[model samples]
Target: MTDRAKGWLVDLRPDERWDDEACCGDLPAEETRMADRLCDSASAATYIRARSVIRRGLAGLLGEPPAEIRLASEVGGRPVLPDHPDWYVSWSRSKSLLLLAARYGEPVGVDLEVIRPISPAAGVLRTVYPRTAELGAVDQSETFFTAWTLLEAAVKATGRGLARGARDVWLYRPSGESRCALGGIRNAGEVPWSGRTEQFAVPGSSTRVMTAVVTKGFTDPIHVDAWQLPDRPPSPVTAAAPRRLLRKEVSA
Candidate 1:
């Protein structure tokens, strides 16, 4: 199905297992090799887990075991979807939670932060967040992280490494906890289109949370499913933001 027809926004549980073979079965050796090559063990594991979750979700919808999807990339390091060429796939993870957004050719991006607090990353923030100067003074960790994730998500959406010039990109924050739309940088490409950002409490975990940014051309319907171990208290921070989208149609 095309992304514009409205599909799913899957929120995978860090602890539950699905019956789909595409997810639970053994992955090809090359896939495992790529994970092994990741810079950090924790990040690699998170990546593997997110891929599994996406495979399982896709299997259920396609009514067949998903095919082997490899993580190939261009010289610039952007992940290529050779198997699912028609779909745009973007995922992000923080701590135990994993977020996924799939849509049409329009680049899609998703990001989550373990809501607690982190010491500002020195001058890095100022370097990447030129718009922060216009944001006035703000000392809250959430404020900093919110802006940080937005820019990060935008870069991820562009498939450009965060170093390409994050400071040039800007996000318009209309309110402290309200949704902000992605826009262009003063001397950079605006990355074309719209997006939404929302926060959710970590289910059954008192010490964490998440925020997601899904960019323009995601005309697909939005669905968010939260999972938790049995008998755990429900997390009350689930939220979603979807916008009407029109994507450029390219010939096959």
Candidate 2:
């Protein structure tokens, strides 16, 4: 079966009043405690928003109540559905933007980074991505962020994260495709990533936002969509109610 992945981008600007009760009331106890430990309201808000997006997105995909979807982190801080091991998910946030990617049948990872000038680009390139440095002089900010997101998405997909060393993964453009159209990652000391990847700009942002997704067994083209929160929150699910089972088939 061909694996399928879906992604959603959420904006975290303070313009909208975040419905804390509806968005975060269903979070697991551990997540609630972690949110409480955030140093400031902004950080807490961002965390809540990210979790809310994940729940809502997953709920829609699984046809279940958002409040009933529970997410837990594995050993390396990778999010997983304890009840559904077949599903894979990954998330990343940059400043006021958050990205969430999920797939069925195969693992997937996503990353987003705001493009900005990197003052000491050489140090970062030399330490984490010496191969990227050899690409020759280019837009320092764009090059660094592009390579950074690619490596992050690859590692996240593999579930090893940066602990495996960013330098260990190499990102390359496949022949006969736009730089953003197709990319691949090869891990030096681990199993290679033989999945599809797509990178694009986020919509409606003044600052350039770059995002990437790495998926296994997904050969189809990827589609990026903007996710808008519902104006009226759905009724919260009660503990007495039974949770719905994830559907075996997912629509493209």
Relative to the true structure, how large is the alpha-carbon lDDT of every model?
Answer: 0.51, 0.63
**CA lDDT, candidate 1, residue 208:** 52
- In model 2, the worst 10-residue window by lDDT is 243-252
**Can you list the residue pairs that collide in candidate 2?**
none
If scored against the real structure, what TM-score would every candidate get?
Answer: 0.68, 0.75
Write one digit per residue (lDDT tens) for candidate 2, span 132-235. 54555434555556666777887787777774656556665434423322244544333334433344455555666778777764453345576465233364
After superposing candidate 2 on the true structure, give the runs of residues whose Cα lies further than 4 Å from its correct spot.
1-4, 163-165, 173-205, 230-252
lDDT of 1 by residue, 1-252 (tens): 522322233334333453222232324445545655666544554555565666544444333343344446656555556766665666666655666655655666666777665555424467756556665443565556666777776777667656774655676656664334566544334345555556666546564554556465434544445542111112221111110100110110
Model 1 gets an lDDT of 0.51
User: Candidate 2 at 58: error in angstroms?
Assistant: 1.2
